[model samples]
Target: MDLVAINLIDGLFYGLLLFMLSAGLTLIFSMMGILNFAHASFYMLGAYFAYQISLYLGFWAGLLIAPPLVGVLGALIERYGLRRVHQFGHVPELVFTFGLAWLIEEVVKFIWGNNMMAYQEPEILKFALFHIGSNSIQAYKVFMIFTSMAIFIGLLFILTRTRIGLIIQAALSYPKTVEALGHNVPLIFMGVFGVGTALAGVAGVLAGPSLGTFPGMAVVLGSIVFVTIVIGGLGSLWGALIASLLIGWMTTAAASSSFQFATLLEFFGMTPPADLDESYLRDLWTLSLPQIGPILPYIFMILILVLRPYGLFGKRDA
Candidate 1:
């Protein structure tokens, strides 16, 4: 029971972290119809930026300052780099963003080197909030949970209840109509792109200490972020939240489980050969849930795509 509780909490934390990254990507895709392949790169930038800022001003200050900086950079990229390529269609946009991702990764390596930075959670949050059996739940994990939940609630309110939200949504389907109403449609695009990247930056800041601030951090989570948004349905915020939680819990539970493939095979009336090395099913016989935990999300993604091409919450038009 204690182990289950621990896994649940851990899964929730991880799910929210993925949501922070995926939300922005989802938003960008919904508005601009651009996937923004470099989204995770911005996430990496956030961590590195926070790490540097934390050195001078502390974690709280870094938390406040770093995301805005990343947002501004994203805005500039939209205004200059992405904007120039926008006229060329999505292929150009994708290629540009893909190259940009590589550029950002190289730049990070050049600036921060290949080692993990000394980034850590604030000292005030270092203590355990509580414990389950021998497992301790730190204050930092709780903080991250509340913080992510707050972000989700705040975004939901803004997108569904606010006038600006209506305008943003309208612009997606009727840009000319929105522009005719005196809204700077292009500016809206830039802002949405900026905001999306900024959300990624925020994820980086929060995850930096817990996951480690390293150059390869973006690459590590990049593909998974796409899987998250896809499984959640491309543009659905609620879908993102649900899928994130599902993945978080699934991966966490699998990692903590001792269940084996051999057991599963036996349950299905299959038996492994005594000379396992010569058997075709040797690998399957030796496999354990924990060994495949990391790839579970990908497996889940394939299933989701196979069953629902538009995703769980995505529209056919989307």
Candidate 2:
């Protein structure tokens, strides 16, 4: 059905957005053991930075330049800030990044004002790319899908085939050993952190149009990114990808469904309350899937943690 098709496409787009953010977190928090609470801050920067750059350069230039700039900032943070805290263990690193997240938010509010900006898609991509029955799909959404796929493919090639990726992977397991082998492990960590944050930046740039560009945008997305990587499994690249898509589809499905708790109550052989407003559980019984769609991923995450502990594709429990 057209409805199913639309949901699938929408889910893929949402999933890819999550992937862009979660992919970086997996590399940083999962693979590299860096608790980067500020990762989504970089994502927020991307939208704001792109908005500023796009004012002078154009959307294409913003798309090209903003992420690298954000990446450089991330690398700088890793090199100067996070590296200094490394001696104190992950607790300090987490605390540092957590503080840094709030710091970035304050800086953004100072620079951009505490309001959402009009970060629209380019004129070229404003039209519909295709249609499903009566529904027209925006060209921008199609562009996002392809762009995310390209990034995923490029990243896969880099990690599996490239020399830098091999070195990075080696450093993930044995930083001291890699350093002993004459590789600059610290530089690798910086590079990984930079790239990871760059990916988040890309997501921010792409999502700003629909998600709204604001200082608090990062806060809205930050926890979801962690849930995604956790549900996917720590230290597992493929796990992140699977979990991102799964959550995306699940969310889209829930949002589009008409199902409510009342439906479930009937299946359980319970009579509907004659005066719903008077019932103590009126809200619970009347709640539709779409009403709780945003938190559905978290619910599923809790279930995964309770049932599987290690996630669908996790190698080991943390």
Candidate 3:
């Protein structure tokens, strides 16, 4: 029971972190029709930015300032780099972003080297908030959970209940119409892209201390971000949330499970060959759920794609 409780809380924390990372990518793709290959680089930037800022002004200030700074950088990139590439079509856009990702990684390695930064959570949040059996739940984990939940709620409210949200949504489908109404459609696109990247920045700010701040940090979570949005259905916020949580819980549960393939084979009355040393299926029989936990999400993604090509909540057109 204690193990179950621990896994549940840990899974929720991980799921929300994934959602924070994926939300920005989803927003950028939905608005600009561009799948940003360099989005995770911005996330990496946020962590480094926060780490540097925290050295002087402290973690709270870094949390407040790093995201906006990253957002401004994103807006500039859209204005100059992506905007020019947009005229050349999707392939060029893909190439541009892909190159940008590599460039950012190289830059990070040049600046920060390959070592992990000494980033740690604030002193205030370092203590345990609660305990389950012998395990303690740290306050920082709870803080991350609440912060992510607040972001989701704020985003939901903005997109559904505000005038700016209505304008942004309208611009997507009727750019010329929005332009006729005295709104700059291009500026709106720039703003959406900036905001999207800022969301990614926020994820990095929160995840840095917990996940480590390093040049390779972006690479660790980069492909997984795409997997999340694809499984949730492109441009579907609800789908992203659901998929993130599902993946979080699934991976956590699998890692906690002690079940082995050998046990399953035995249950099915398929005994391992006595000449186990040379048996073709020897390795297969030795596998355990925990050993394969990291790949569970990919497996789940494949299943989702096979059964529902459009994704769980994605529109057919999407």
For all candidates in order, the CA lDDT equals 0.94, 0.90, 0.92
Candidate 1 lDDT over 1-318, as tens digits, reads 889889999999999999999999998998888888899999999999999999999999999999999999999999999999999999999999999999999999999899999999999999999999999999999999999999999999988899989999899789999999999999999998988889999999999999999988999999999999999999888889999999999999999999999999999999878899999999999999999999999999999999997888999877
Arrange candidates, best lDDT first. 1, 3, 2
**TM-score of every candidate:** 0.98, 0.97, 0.97
Candidate 3: C-alpha lDDT: 0.92
CA lDDT of 243 in candidate 2? 94
**Pairwise lDDT winner, candidates 2 and 3:** 3
After superposing candidate 2, which stretches have Cα over 4 Å from the reference?
A: none
Residue-level lDDT of model 2, residues 165-207, one tens digit each, is 8988888777899999999888888898999999999998999
Clashes of 1: 0
In candidate 3, what are the lDDT values of residues 1-318, reduced to their tens digit? 999999999999999999988888987888788999999999999999999999999999999999999999999999999999999999999999999999999998999899999988999999999999999999999999999999999998998899998998898777899999999889999999899889899999999999999999999999888889989998888989989998889888999999899998899999888888898889879999999998889988899899998888889977
TM-score winner, 1 or 3: 1
